[model samples]
Target: MPARRRQQGPRRLEEFAFINLIKRRFGRVPRRVAMGIGDDAAVVRGPSTRDWVVTTDLLAEDVHFSLDTTSFDDLGYKAAAANLSDIAAMGGSPTYLLIALAIPTTLSQSDLSRLYQGLHRACRPHHVALIGGDTSSSRAGLFLTITLIGEIARGRAVLRSGARPGDLLYVSGTLGESQAGLMLLGKALTRGIRRGLAPADRARLIGRHRRPTPRVALGEALASRRLATAMIDLSDGLSGDLAHLCEESRVGALLDRSALPLSPALRRFAALAGSSAESLALQGGEDYELLFTLSPRHEAAVQRLGRQLRVPVTNIGRMMPARFGMKERDRHGSLKDLAVTSYRHFT
Candidate 1:
């Protein structure tokens, strides 16, 4: 999974910094890889013709979700989708999935079945198989950890380190709706009263959060055409994920606020909630959209590719030199530093 780093936090070792510590402590673990530690997935040398892309994600009850807002079916589907998004980021086709679950004894068998149904539904379209997994009883709540394996042509895995200073930054699909959906799911704190929303809008926003689509076809298309210079999925929101990409590639980014994609539902929700859609677009997590960089000259080809795939790819920013850091131009033509307020586990 991509790192969920927040801009502000208490006195503690941050997630990525902790990751770096692990990398240093276990630096001699003797694992051969094409890429490791810092990207969406770890690429390992596999067969003569292809390489393996592997990633894992863990979702804990209360910490990641609650039975109050999420159903068993939606939970299972989102878990699978999250892992699939990782493979999408690596530009690989998912092959197998293994789930390790710590289930509470109180959960009914029917609920468990619904969970598995969700997992199956997500994997079926991509032709991926649930090879094997482990189950154990938990005194606490449910804890699910999924490990996914994927494959790509040898030496063809796209990475976060490939972005250059001049590459254009693009994202597929609209942003911020998932976050809006999550807000609607919970008791939204708007002037200490529940705001009435249209039934259709409510359903749409909730669905976005519950069932995010992994951009498998878009990722494959970009990889096959050699279009993207660097790629990442928007799991941790645009601000943090883009920061991760810039840090890895030693580049910076300048975002055009007007270019940020906003869905109509999100705009309406933002207005009702007394917030801006742009804030939600930048700070919301689990959007699962792909953020990639492309050279300026290939813009036309990518636009055509987006049309062919039926995925809207928007050019929202441009990569810049590292010294410039990450900044954004507001709609009013004012420049300011882009703050990363995405979800972070410890914060």
Candidate 2:
């Protein structure tokens, strides 16, 4: 579920930050540990044979979000939600969170409280605890970081390399809506003109862009039922994200363009932006939905999961032999090569 974070040259970090990064990276985990650095989090052995899932995420001012289109409350909410999504992708239950922030001189005390308030709002429902974190002054805009600790049953954490040739690719909820929402928040001149939209529609689009929900419950359900062979969160676009999974599994895939799950909001927004819905759904990042693959035999079970969770799940394609290559088939029955169209943060 971890997205590819684009890094600049060498990064200068605080002493503790440096230690955490280096230790977590090069330090060897004990025999009891389940995983390290490769999966959603560093899963270690917990009490009573439970597995501990730990992950950290960052949200920089201009790099991840801008104040122009986002509020402090949503910013705090989204930062926590991003880390929560990582736990969800791992089929773990989020239990504790540590928030670190680099505050700017431009913000007031009241504003800072509102930010924490938003974080609390997100954690209350999931029963996640706010442990502690460090605070620092920033010369630039706000920089936020979150470290989430979660738990799952031992040996139950799903990975992205289990996908096989006959496994069917499935995605939870709709795609492209988040990107379409971001487009609406961009420049008015660049976004183009559209009319006859209701207030609710505008709110829906903007909300999707600002705040997104993590599929935690559904993730646990999928893992508990042994429904998914491989699972990953859609932080990057489906195009590049799926390629990462395929590469890890040593397989190829075929995406059915006609079966892509898109929303009415996406169609309407694409028409206004003079772009196609499929392109947005394929390349748009930050949707935060679950994309996993399962065997064809589980088709009936997947349908049941969809209904039980009240989450719309779509079978977009199937895994193929590596020699066949990763490609997409259009509704017109045309086969085309698929490209890694995901956004690179550094670029």
Candidate 3:
């Protein structure tokens, strides 16, 4: 009888492995590109009708994720999602990506294949191409760097500084869901009991953490209709992103705690864990939803956009004079400083 084969096969150089995989995926050079992967630099044509948008993000092992908790596919997906979220926040459509992937000795050829597959899955729907990238061996765990390039019609890219004193603060979809998902995963990890959560609940929370959707469609719609006054993505939590937007616009904001949207899943998780959904919504990061401001006069228009796009648009607050500071209105209609800070590395 033949001996059982090891899960990981014989290894090869990083370049040899990745290049072969990329060539298999590409099959053909795209019409818009004068060059493909394996070049010193990628040369591709830009859309003449739109301005270029570029964003870079990094996902590191230990800092961003642990393989024990999530798969290589999920790491790839979240890394792409995070970069795509940046393009979406600008009211643009992602079109291209350049990756710098560092693989640790722990990863095998199959692992790399699965990781890139997840990245491709994230980009395929958005018509994004993987143009060029560099691969290197890593002494540490996995490190993924993705640079996404996108486009918005000339003069249509939303800036974080466009918000005004009277603009309404809005967020797409519910907050706290992703953070709750992270906490649940952490809980399961800590207790060493994966079955603590109901099967459905486990899937929901972990999926939210693993695969986040970029709001490109809604962002494009908002920009095309001239609806958003200012925009940002919820990478740094509501409190932190709100502070960033206000800082950019030189304005202040008043968030209504009652108006903040929370998902039923998050509510349930919070109840079970004795955690505060409000706190999660405010300070939890990695939501990847768009947060935008719009003029008060366009209230109806914003609602129409939301319905047309079939994405929830919650009006959580309004912009105010910068001197007024960032404040939140409690359910009792009392105002207090939104003193919470979002998560920061090494803080």
- Each candidate's number of clashing pairs is 0, 0, 0
Which lDDT tens digits does candidate 3 get at residues 28-53? Answer: 55689777675567788876778999
Q: Given candidate 3, what's the lDDT at residue 231?
A: 97
How does each model score on lDDT? 0.81, 0.77, 0.82
Q: Please give the distance, in angstroms, between residue 94's alpha carbon in candidate 3 and its true position after superposition.
A: 0.4
lDDT by residue (tens digit), candidate 2, 1-347: 22112212222233234335423322343454555433344454466778888999988887888887778888888888888888888888887666667777687665766677677767766877554455566778899889999888888888888899989999998887777777677775252344544556667777876778888998888887888988888888899889988988888999999999988877777776678999989998878899999989888998898898899999999999889889999999899998779854311
- Model 3 spans with C-alpha error above 4 angstroms: 1-14, 26-29, 188-197, 344-347
Instruction: Name the top TM-score candidate.
Output: 3
RMSD of 3: 5.6
Ranked candidates (lDDT, high to low): 3, 1, 2
Enumerate residue pairs that collide in model 2. none
User: Sorted on TM-score, highest at the top, how do the candidates line up?
Assistant: 3, 1, 2
Please report how far candidate 1 places residue 225 from its true position, in Å.
1.2
TM-score of each: 0.84, 0.84, 0.91
